[model samples]
Target: MYENKISARQLRRMIFIETFGAGALSIPAFACYKEQNGFWSLIFYGVFLAGTIAFFIIFSGKISEENFENRKIGKTGLARNVNINVSKMQTRLKSINFPEVLPQPIKFVYMIRFFINAVALFYFFGKTIQTVYMPESSFLFIIFPAAILLCYSLYTTLQKRARFLEIIFPWIITTYFIAVILSFIGIEKAMQIGNAGELWQGILSDNIFRSMGNGYLMLLCSSPIEFLLFLRPAAEERGTETKNRKVEDKNNKEGKNNREGKDDKAIRDIITAVAGAILCNVLFCFLSVRTLGPTLTSQSEWPVIKMMQLIRMPGGFLERFDILPIIFWILCMMAVLSGYLYYGWSIFQTRSGGCLKNFLGITFVCLVLLTCVVEKHTLLWTFYLKYKAFVDFPLSLILPLVVWLFKRQKDFNYQEKT
Candidate 1:
């Protein structure tokens, strides 16, 4: 067992299954739940959950099987030989510590990641406490210190980490799935008496944008791409050791046309990343729609517990549990903060060229926290005006400019060589 380890393709499939498990179920289902009837909503969400799990299994299996068959000459060697090599590789990989190629300044990105992770996560924790415990716990006072502690613990644990995700990722996703199922049930019950209209009215009448806290939710799209980009500068260095080697663009046969095609593919990938960001914006819009009722109530300091009091589930040892609201809020916060940290690290790793990295991460985190804190304190009319000028405008406008500038630089370098 120790000698014969899975290949990189298998690892990637595992990562996808691990990363996307609970998240896939919750996002689309929760977004559209209010738009459909309770019985139908339950069925719709059920299908969504089933579809996601199926996709994971089928996709992962296909990739793993493909890797198994497309074995390099070395892969098809004697089983004993392959096992010995596998054991050696596994031992070597285990002995590795921090990514050696990463520069020291980039480590600061880890710090910023932790900081943003703390703020987004703890802020929501405050709201959760609002639901279960007291709302007046000066959540920051509680959460800030907690963030520091968690970060320190995280640093130590990560240094010693080995196959942590292989175990934890599946569990996190499963927990997330359970939480979403519960939220769906809650949403279904809430909609039974035609309460959707009331929530919609509150959203329209109240400040839903501020409640959702800027377009930070939309940053979810960029989060994945940001990591991909971080992976990019390193990709040109990785050779074919990682997965998807078979899909690599041919460089040896390069002619003018092939070179242009490669450039075009790079351009296309960047555009795809940008397009993903836009799709996330749309998804966040849906999430904003779902959240209208909850945010408005939270802003008014209305007991979130009371709002959820009508929601109940039955049929299990945990059926009497009414903690779905807290779960949704916490998971949402966890996803957002974890995303911020992941992207913040990517940006940090890439931006070691200047203080620009620090500026971007700090600005992003500050805006996210401010949007949430102020929403709870003020009305929608005033907050929307502020949010539009500050948050939404920068992401929509400034982010494009950054991409455009990078593309232009690449074009100029190509022209100079020609």
Candidate 2:
């Protein structure tokens, strides 16, 4: 049934939309917001999520069309009937001289990044499980198996979905939102924390700004997954056109040879990438601060959660709706795993020759182990907020800056060549 139905475009949508917003990283965003802003902040969060989804939809359409055109050109080995225009891809490629499509190295630094994220997420996930669910006796057994399964499932799922990341992503996103809202509704009113008035004020003030920053940082982990997601539909479309052109190579050969062409810019592509980074990061900060910034630090085993034990959400109708949040969490967790797994596997497939991939995988494994050990032992339990701040803020600024510097060097070299 699935085989006959899925298309390349749909697969691209799924990868970008579904996998991009996965669980491993999103929980931190939720935790941050809940700790700082309290429950009502979710309203604003929903709005922001909706807006990004819309932006993704428009961009995905443009990218898919260009990819299709490229495939046709490749298939016929000639350019025909093609109308040239300025596009996001052209702009992005302009910055790096297209980098000659070199193999990506998974070096020591890449491994370090992976390990840090893995360990952090592992610890956070364990703590959450202990607090919100039952404390498992074997943390390693629980986390490792869960992580591996998620990765494997995601790798298989994307291929099965006709490689439509965009289509899959929207459903995942919608499911995640519903889950969060349902969880908010289900918390017992008796379990609600913080004074309503104070929380509201915090939500309106600098708290929202903090949330926005965290949101941007979270996007960093997810953005790579988004880029890969766009590839599925693009690939499928190209493949289809390639097959069709193979059959028509003779009759249309002369006309295809008689076509006109224009220059495509790589500058625009780089600018678009940088612009996308900035816009996403800024919006993330506002949403995080407004909805979950103040309460996030507190709720997630931080100093704040301890202080606010007195105030709790009234379960109200949610008490009757207990099953919903559990279901939502399950779905969200799946989405997150799918994302990480998809990217990890893709890395393995495309660039396994270098030490970088091995290093990265090992680093992530160490991180997962470290997190389990830290939480179980209560290590670094006190300075958690400071540590989190360091990780989130600096990385958010560095990604775009590095991209920009590389772009500058490329431009200078281009001018020299001219």
Candidate 3:
């Protein structure tokens, strides 16, 4: 069923881009608001996140093994009766099968949650363009072209999206790194951390608990590593194919080892990408706090971007180096917006009928109209922030863990019966 598979490298890039979306720009502000050191909070949360993801990877591997074994056994009469059940479970486990797993009311809520998030992101994208590049342009005009482009992108294949990310990943990283480096110039010396003791003290300060809580919430809302749950099965692993019947039978005994190797590689790639993105976010947050004091950082809407504007290029070589980060930030936001649309649409596609295309067309029109009508960006942000913890936590973290545990128990029971 998975014909157009992306390489592990492409998968890593996708994860990084998704995890480091435009939401990351607000990390420093969030830290400042909570009155905590952004660097320390991010480090602590990042370690916790990495550990959780590692456990999830292990669980996913076990489920994949069970699925593979069940498929293999289905070729024989002994397991024929359980093939349908196994296939259903595998389908639910492999992808974002929320529509299948969730009840109608809960599914409706999930749909609404994702829709609101997509609209907010779309609105944010338009707002960024209007604020940074086209201050004179109408908001509608700014988003109209962007919405059209997003629709076109949504129509494209996953492989195409992954390829596009691969093409721009290096450029985006370089631009961001340049901005980060330039941001260090002309900053107050006292604002910077002087020694390891200061850094350690920051980590163990009185507000550490609050900082960790806020960091966890930020990680939940900002990091889209949950996308990896859907992407892993589609990511191609090397040395997993059998060339011929002879080779297949010869290596049949080694199949488990091969699967283990593939799982290990996937785990490593995902962890690396996630960790790199987290580190980048930490650096950006740290720079924002250092360049702009906590007061300004918390007050500013886009602290990182504002910090970029404070950058003074040496020798006046680049009059406005901030524009580079803006452009790259827009690219990252585009990837994130595309991911939201694509994954949300995929959920509908799974259950829809022959009129699915028509339904999507109507839905696109409504989405664009909603984006246009939702002018209260502040209210949207408030609403999202107020309820995101409730929704995203359950959907992203709780749901997957519940599914994994259920599958594990079922597999164990099956083994006992056998």
Candidate 4:
């Protein structure tokens, strides 16, 4: 696990890419749901997500400290048992098996959820390429190469993936921001046509509860914070560990301080990544409605791409400036697809080779075939939109709260014993 560890910086970049790519795709839907008020909905969700993440991180640190102190004091009571059970549950969730604490049926359902998500990602990736770049090409022609590339990527090390993201992070951000800025040209054109004020026609929804309900669904589908459950454990805090024995005693206090600082940095990194992605989504949502006039934006399958096509490069330096953003967006989509497949692969214990790997590989092939056999992409989207709520709500929000409550009870019991 130490050898496979990624830094907080790498984790931040990974989160940003995953969240931004996935959220951008769903922005048009959210826009349709709330009209121009979607940006406000995104802001509210971002703030709520930030506060939730901060609380989780702080409480997780406290739990870790308490576990450590209990270990040092040789107290193998309720606290230690509870901690061990939680650790086992995390391990099982990430690696293999379903912990006894969760019902057996949940394991089967979770496996189905992972498969559905992976297939949906692959389908969307191929569909986007076919729609935008190769309208004439067969979907098979587009997806086959992508599947091969994704398989190759899965065989590579996590460190390499993280490093790749770190290197490309700046370029992705720049390309996306440039696209957003260029989109303002469309807004300017709309203003010249005397429809600029229409952009704010429904900036605040009259039915706030309806807006919130739709936004919550959008947040569940878009936000990648659930990845942190797997990613955070793999993120190594810088300066928290050292190889030099001579300085161990001297740097004990320094190491403690560094740990605290690094934890704060980790929390900041997460908040920044999530908030940045949300803001980017909001910007694109705003630009899409402003340029496409809300009605068309709501109707279009890919409103962001449509908005990009409407953008003309200044001075005609390039006839198709939209090509640049489309290319960058393709890269972002590939990253997102890879992330989904990689995490799904991890859950099947692919690292431990032999029969298990073979079995999982076969299962993956079946998923790809299933993706291909599914003729109606719209139905797939409908299924995902309708069902993901059940999966995301319980897993993302309720699960964490339940764990926190259980830990608090264990801590209370431990204190009573002491």
**Candidate number achieving the greatest TM-score relative to the actual structure:** 3
lDDT of 1 by residue, 1-418 (tens): 1111322332332323323322332333232333321222223333433333343333222222111111223344466664554322211011111222234543454445445434543454555465456656665554554344333322222112213333443454455346445545655645423377774554455333332332232222223322222222221112323322443333323333433453344334434433332343233233323533333322433223343444465643464333543454444344434434444543454455533435544545564555367437646435543553465434433332344344456556867996
Per-candidate local distance difference test: 0.37, 0.41, 0.67, 0.62
* All models, RMSD in angstroms: 13.1, 10.2, 5.5, 7.1
Tell me the spans in candidate 2 whose CA falls farther than 4 Å from its real position: 1-108, 151-158, 161-240, 243-320, 348-350, 354-368, 377-418
TM-score of every model versus the real structure: 0.43, 0.49, 0.81, 0.77
Q: Give me the runs in candidate 4 sitting further than 4 Å from their true place.
A: 34-39, 55-111, 191-201, 237-239, 243-256, 313-316, 350-355, 376-378, 401-418
Q: Tens digits of per-residue lDDT for model 3 on 1-418?
A: 3334577898888888887765667767876665665655666677767866765565555434424332232234656554454333211112333334443444455456667777878887887777877899988888877777777765667778889999989988888887776666634443465589876776666376776776776666454666665577667643333222234433344655655676677778888888888778778777877667666877876887787666554577777766767767788888887777776665555545222556556667876888777765467667766566776655666666665666668768988998
Ten-residue segment with the worst summed lDDT in candidate 4?
90-99
**Error at 373, model 3, angstroms:** 2.9
Best-to-worst lDDT order: 3, 4, 2, 1
The true-versus-predicted C-alpha distance at residue 378 of model 2, in Å, is: 4.3
- Output the lDDT of residue 68, model 2: 13
Q: Which segments of model 3 are wrong by more than 4 Å?
A: 1-4, 55-59, 62-110, 185-206, 238-246, 353-355, 402-418
For candidate 2, write residues 1-418 as lDDT tens digits.
Answer: 2332234345334443333333332434453543544233334443444444444443333332221122232322235335543221111111111112222432232334433444555566555555554665566655776666543443354446444343344455465455444434433342334587876666575466655654544444443333322332233332444444454444334423321110111212322333443343233333333333445533543222222232234543333332333343445444544544444444444455533435445544754666666776665653554554575335423433344355456556877996
